[model samples]
Target: MDPRKQRSRDRLYAAALELAAEHPIADLTVTQLAGAAGVHRSTFYEHADSPQALVEAALTAELDVLREELLKDRADAATAVAKVTEAVLRHILIHVDLYRRELADGAGGLHAMLSRHFRGTTETLLERGRIDLDVTVEGMPPARVADAAARFLADGTVGIIDGWLRHPSARVEDFLRVYAALLPSWWPHSPAA
Candidate 1:
């Protein structure tokens, strides 16, 4: 990536996070983002089509890094999983206001994107046999079971996070405890274990 382009993207991402913390990205205009980012509208267009797109790209980039690290860390699967999950939760907590606004409706774009990203990540881990499932449904093929499990974990986790964000008094530690308790017994790195 060109240094100039990278700088522009960084500016855009910073501006998006700042602005999104105050207002829902859906209600923000591209012009507002361009002005906040100190980039021309054309420059903004070069990166993302909408403010929501830019915010999603910026947020998911962090998650992608965590996912890559999780795949590379082989010394302790359980610890690695716990660390990554905590990192993810902390990341959201850091931007709690932004997430609260974005996910206020429960079925917002951010929620859907997160669900898709998590579902894909879980599917990858399962396909690689990085995670084990201790329970099996009757008469279901392994692949079918894996898909169902992935969707369940992804959607359930996202839904829980969304609910937590919607509640103003919910603490991160409390959410983590609940999340860990809800994980399947075979899941590695469960804080509850």
Candidate 2:
């Protein structure tokens, strides 16, 4: 796509996410997004196949932002765990509305968001962490460890976020922090020795 068109789509998705923060995705419409973004309706569709598509795009954009930001934020050995944990915690805090709204209706929104971003990203994080924790982790292959960690984190964390969303006003930080502590416990040495 042309640079100008790419920027327009980016703006439209940005508008869509901003709107989604205040309202449920089900409540949002193309017209509202187009107006908020100052782009034509046709132009909005050029960026995404639908409003949900826009959500997906917006989230994917955030994931890229997070990947760069989190990885660059720190690179030390002992710190990566805390870094990933804190990154996820802070992310949920910032987007609590969006997260809660996603889970309001039996977690349909949660499912969508997972399919959109966290699933693959979780796997990637697991693999990366495993590689980094080589001395602490022993001999597991990166793919297996990554796959397990991804599945474990995605499933359990999604459920926890759903609960937090259901409550809406609760502080989930401590809850997520403890959960983060469990992650490194999976390191092979912790289990074998």
Candidate 3:
């Protein structure tokens, strides 16, 4: 990555985060984002196809760091899982308003992107034998089972987070409790347990 290009991307990401905190990503225009980023519209296009795409890229990059930490070879899987999960929850809490606005209309682009990200991360962990499925359906192939498990975990977790974000009285601890209760007993850790 060229230094100039990297700087431009950083500017765009920072601006996107700031603007997203104020308005829904779907309502944001490329021209507004480029102006906020202090970059030309052409430069914005060089980085992302749309304002939503830019915001998704910027947010997911932050989540990817925690995913990497969760994937590392730690001695205590439970502790590592708890730490990473808490970190991720804290990250979401920090941007709660942006998430609330994006998810207000139900399963939209941000929700789908989050589901895909979670599903991909789960699949990678499964492939590396970092996690195990506690239940298996009769006559189901291992590959299909893995895929189903990934989708289930991804969709269910995202759904729970979506509901939590929408609820007026929802607290981080309450969300964590529900999240921990919903996980399989075989899961490495429970943040609220």
Runs off by more than 4 Å, candidate 2: 72-74, 126-149, 181-184, 187-193
Model 3: per-residue lDDT, tens digit, 37-102?
999999999999999999999999889998898888464666777777778778888888898888
Model 2 has a clash total of: 0
- Best candidate according to lDDT: 3
Candidate 1 lDDT by residue in tens digits, 1-193:
9999999999999998888889888888899999999999999999999888999988888788888887887746677778788878888888889888888788788888788878887887777787877678889988898888888888898888988887788687888888878887767754334
Ranking by TM-score: 3, 1, 2
The TM-score between candidate 3 and the true structure equals 0.93
Rank the models by lDDT, top first: 3, 1, 2
Model 1 vs truth, CA RMSD:
2.0
Superposed by TM-score, candidate 2 places the C-alpha of residue 124 at a distance from the truth, in angstroms, of: 2.3
lDDT of all the models against the reference?
A: 0.84, 0.66, 0.85
Residue 15, candidate 3: how far off, in angstroms?
0.7
Clashing pairs in 2: none
Model 2, 117-191: lDDT tens per residue?
556655555556533433224697766756665566666666666665676465656565545555544432121
The segments of candidate 1 whose C-alpha lies over 4 angstroms from its true place after superposition are 191-193
Give the poorly placed runs of model 3, Cα more than 4 Å off: 190-193
